[model samples]
Target: MNTPVSALMPVGWGILLGLLAQSASAGFIDNSSATLTARNFYLDRDYKGESPYPAAREWAQGFILKASSGFTEGTVGFGLDATGLLGLKLDSSPDRTATQLLSYNPVTREARDEYSELGITFKAKVSKSKLSIGTQFPSLPVITASPARLLPQSFRGAYLISDEWDGVTIHVGRMDRVNLRDSTDYGPIGLASPNGRFRPGATSERFDFYGGEYRPATNLTLRLLRAELDDIYTQDFLGVLHLAPMGEGTFKSDIRVFNSREDGRAKAGSIDNLNVGGMFSYRWGAHSLGVGHMRQFGDSAFPYIAGGEPAVLSDGTMSADFVNPGERTWAVRYDYDFAGVGIPGLTGMMRYLHGDSIDLPALGGRDLKESSKDFELAYVIQSGPAKDLVFRVREAFYRNQQDAGSTFRSDNETRINIDYTLKIW
Candidate 1:
């Protein structure tokens, strides 16, 4: 007979709680929930002769445990949240692999076997305000977890969120380390430190941020955000979100603008970047349409996640990573709900993205262009024994053009996800 970790978790937690009660002012186990999920994906790429890398095919499996509970009653309400994650490499080959679940060693051309992490957050609330210290999963314009792959990325930091004022909410935080979606180790972000090269190090620490959202009206929300990345840059953002009724359904719109500039040591020289984007969606019955455009200005690329040490580049240029000095992107999408067809919990969406005028340094010049088109189809089971089960399929075709070289490639991915939740309180 084998005892599963899930079965023994409550006993272990009970013992730990007893030990903490001996030292802590007050403690309690109020709520517990467990979830299990898995993902299957496939990818393929075809490059021109002597391309920098070969084609890839891979699949991944992941398990995540999130447990949270409220602390003993006191002057200030206290709580603790803990998360555990496990990732396994189910399938991969030298020619086809991804860094979503495991980091690939370029030299060895092999993926790591398994990766895991444990994160905890301690929080206190007082008079409509809350403060937390510990690792957190953040989703903001400046600092957001990248869930583009199988597992989502995480950050180690302290944060505070407050809603003391009517119609307004405020957020602020400081982060020092980032655990990417693919790796278990926590590393520093490029903007967080200035180590000459773009590599994760321990010497860098980013300054905290201040931001807020105001919703004076029921249908509109306005946001303002500002942050300073020590020795890297400073960024400010403004956004507006609106929701209104249209026909038999509703209309939604989102507009965002960002102004980024270099500060302090200014490692990446002087930063002068501005991004503007707007998305609009209209729904009539079971069908919806969405369109958006995003543009990047200045001589630098819009920085997001660094993708870790063995970074995955969008271009095929070795020794030269592609972030593009200036880029313009446009997107269009459509969605349909089966509920309108008398079937509930069934929805589908298809989207396409195109980009042009990319800035590349190694193409003998700075005039290069790249574009990609992706199609996706997904369905979720609404009821019955397999309720909440999901199936998805996606395909992407990418093309790059420039005076020096041109190449084309395509990739396909599929995933089957199933999740169930149990509440024990």
Candidate 2:
């Protein structure tokens, strides 16, 4: 029998009170907010040497509803937050399958139509510290949430945050379950041991973590973090971020280092990594130009999500921190605001990324190179009958260098999206 939504109402109400306490000091209830978005995506890939899957195309639509409120009057304030998501298929087939929002069930080998989840958090505050429990989406150095898909990924657990120190903020938490991007069910995040062996049946009911950030100056910040993926691995991270004005815009630099070692019965190996990257941006009128470089060290790839490991030298997000394993990447990007050009609510972006010195041991340990370029243009109706409506177009081209007699091919893709957001508070 399917669980009824009513069964979850009691837990939802409890979480509302906790969240309100955290937002109480700010004053004023948020009232309520909701936004509906739809996307049409088309993706294609042609691999020269491998046949992972055939070229594919797909169209999908999604909707998101978010509601939040302020806490009740008192030293210990209380509030609630909730989100609803839906995704529908516009076009797809077995031969042209895309995993954008739908995944094939392993048992039945059928595509699922939709995925959804509900999250609520309860919060209480004292002085400058706040405590929360229940389901929440947290984005930290060690435990970042994924919102790139239909619904934002969430975790089931509790957390606490404090900002009492002059220039320091501290966070501590424990997470038990995670809802993946393609599935509504929550599962435990598994960790691999250092010795290249799998620790079977070693599951963590919850993972514990603690971290702090301190800013000694106006343009500099230092961070330290520690997390224990119960029975999997214990890791520590240190990072420094600095920002300085250069001409009209700013120059930002980031340096991060991580040390990971096996814990419990998996303490046979270890990973040490260091990442260094910097970006320089200049804005004149409505146009902005940016250039960045990032490099990685150590044998293992940089860690991001709790259980989902990233590929070495893979640029996971636009953050530029995903560069992995004996790799060096450089990117140049430009953004223009049409509003400054008298066309308000219009903007465009273009970027090119080139990577070299990729060490792929599986491909006979040969050094490889790859490059990709992406372009995006978007416009939003600012006012009038169609206010808040948006339209966007994007395209990308990817190419990989190949040796003589190699049978590799390049890939290209184009996508157009139009969305209208209606506020129903």
Candidate 3:
């Protein structure tokens, strides 16, 4: 396959890749591997309050093929990677659409019967540093891909990583387009807003970021990052993760902070936000207990990419982000590993979150509050024919006390996924 961005990328980078490719050796193909994962996913959502669409339920099958080639044997090596995805709808209707399992069918006001996507990445490595161009899957505090539905989100960009520094890693990227989890085409990036969609004319063609992670000790990690969505907003993030021994158990602490402001022309309109949150958990044998808290302070809500996953805070759950102007959230959770009870490969989790003090002056705000209850159970086959097969069930009960006239409604959501992977060499 040809490199999709070979002609669009800068000449200097192209020269480097050309040189590396010319030196290709046996390692380029010897260490290659491919895997295909088959996923059966179903989602059901029931609206709680007054709404035209009462429910949205859909089921689909997805196929994802990931193939990667090893770098050539040299100080400067080259490689390529590709991901192919296909989604087939099994059950859907026009009345009960918008389940995010497939693309929208405007003609029938229903979900499409099928959709597909392809992504390619060209890479070159020099010593311990590597640079990738074309498609990216970033999981960072500033920008991340959302994989909540039948297929995962994707972005077109260039990413670089360097790990030559002792105990430190550096990340830099320039993303230009985004494909939402439910979409098949990549397009301009937009800012996520308080009301669940991007404002009119609020879009950017590029996203730039630089970040680094440091590990000063075996049990501690620190990360700092700065990112900008051109003409829209700029955001900064700092996070700390630590682990300690606590009375026969281990205590884990996670703290994250985000500061955002309008950038350039401020297409998102005068962004100002500070999002602070953390999740702390203690584990003993097979039981884990955790507590989390997140709060948004400033004139505007938290800043994030539309349809992107910002998992920096514990409140970023299946149904709600708990991110609004003056919103503060508190959560508690419990988890158990069934292995302690003789059922290896099984796990369960329960969590509850309460959010209040929302500021929505436009809707009279009116003591705005929201709450969510979540449960998850997962199991994986340990041995036998289904060795690596996985089964997962997730449910969320969410409600908000928004204004009566508001279209936002309380929701009951359920998701089930069964997955199996096959290896091909």
Candidate 4:
């Protein structure tokens, strides 16, 4: 396999992997799981303004292989996990390149036909705690992997998670390098664009974070997290979730808040931001209704992993995230469960979000606004020969307050996805 990125294994990784080879070859084989998934993804976008040679569209096929070994029998258990990813471009051209489905050639301005990536993690378990060293796919409030594309992003480093006490979980880790969602190369962490686009500059090699979650009650969860991207920025997060039974329905509330500031040396410049958001929902039978609100404060935009999808406050889907400097957003959504109507494998969702008070210092201190309407329909095979086969279609219409000549204009995006997984244990 010709992998796009070469891994520089750390010292601890070498030692742990050697131990895994010995144990996993014998005791660990008793309990192990292996799976492979095939994903076919296609995307198309219609620009409202002048297009980059017209609308951008692309299609790609992906294969993901995952293998995990059970822990060796002992007080100090050991195991190994591996992930292999491959993406092949099915339809793409120079005029329809750079849709983030595949890597693009700079000179030719064309997407590559194929790309691959591999990652491994060696784990040690003791009691309720586990430590992993090597590449990882993390999903946390402060940092997360972008799995919305053909290939998900990965981080190269170590992670430690423990749940020694009842109803409480602790997490600590550091990621020095990141493999972006599209490209097959590892690079430093950076800041994300307000519009969820890619941007260059303001990067850091060390991204250190530690956090914990506490569930004091069966229906309540609280989280606190802190992180620092060395020389770039520091961030703190707080989140709360609650669920209550209301008649035959359920009422849910989720709140998230973040505080960020420039770190020592301020490589990403003077950064300051406070993001707060919440979602309230009521679900009864086949129908669910939700409303959300979010606000951004400070002179700078919300800081997150650049070129990657971090689940910031009120950002759940891939279509759009209402996060801009000094921005305020409100959203309403509806969901239907086809299972309640005898369609056991289908579901649909629709949402609309409106945001205003966008501050663009780069565009001469101008303020703008944006809104997005999104819809999705999904289905999955429940059983039989095609069990677990899944299909989904998502569409979004986004309009921003930017001028027509601006690079960020109104556009419509649509994506179609099909996936199937096979177990090889």
In terms of lDDT, the best-performing candidate is 3
Candidate 1's C-alpha runs over 4 A off are 1-19, 22-28, 31-34, 40-50, 191-203, 308-323, 364-367, 402-425
Better of 1 and 4 by lDDT: 4
lDDT of 3 at 9: 63
lDDT string, candidate 1, 1-425, tens digits: 12322243354455346436633444545333445555544434444334445555556676667777655455566666777877777777655555355667767768877777888766666778876666678777667666556567877676789999999999988877778787788877554211122223413455557899999999999999887767777888888999999878889898888777777777656667777777788988889998877777885655443542211112212112224457676767788888888877767767666667776555434565565555656677777877766776655555556432322232233333433433333
lDDT of 3: 0.84
TM-score of each model, paired residue for residue: 0.82, 0.79, 0.94, 0.93
All predictions: root-mean-square deviation over Cα?
A: 7.7, 6.1, 3.1, 3.7
Off by over 4 Å in 4: 1-21, 24-27, 51-53, 194-200, 404-408
Q: Give me the overall lDDT of model 1.
A: 0.62
Report the lDDT tens digits of candidate 2 across residue range 1-425.
12222344465566554454445445426543555555444444433344444455556677767666555456665555566667676666676564455554655545567656666666556677877666667776667666655446677776788999989999888887777766677777654221122333456655778999999998999989888776566778777778888776776666555666556654323434455555566776788887877676666534344333332223332212324356677878889999886999999999888877765454334467767788888999999998878887777676655432222334565666767767676
lDDT of each: 0.62, 0.62, 0.84, 0.82
TM-score of 1: 0.82
Worst 10 residues of 3 by lDDT: 1-10
Q: What TM value does model 3 have? A: 0.94
Candidate 3 segments whose C-alpha is farther than 4 A from its true place:
1-24, 194-198, 364-366, 404-408
Predicted structure with the largest TM-score when compared to the true one: 3
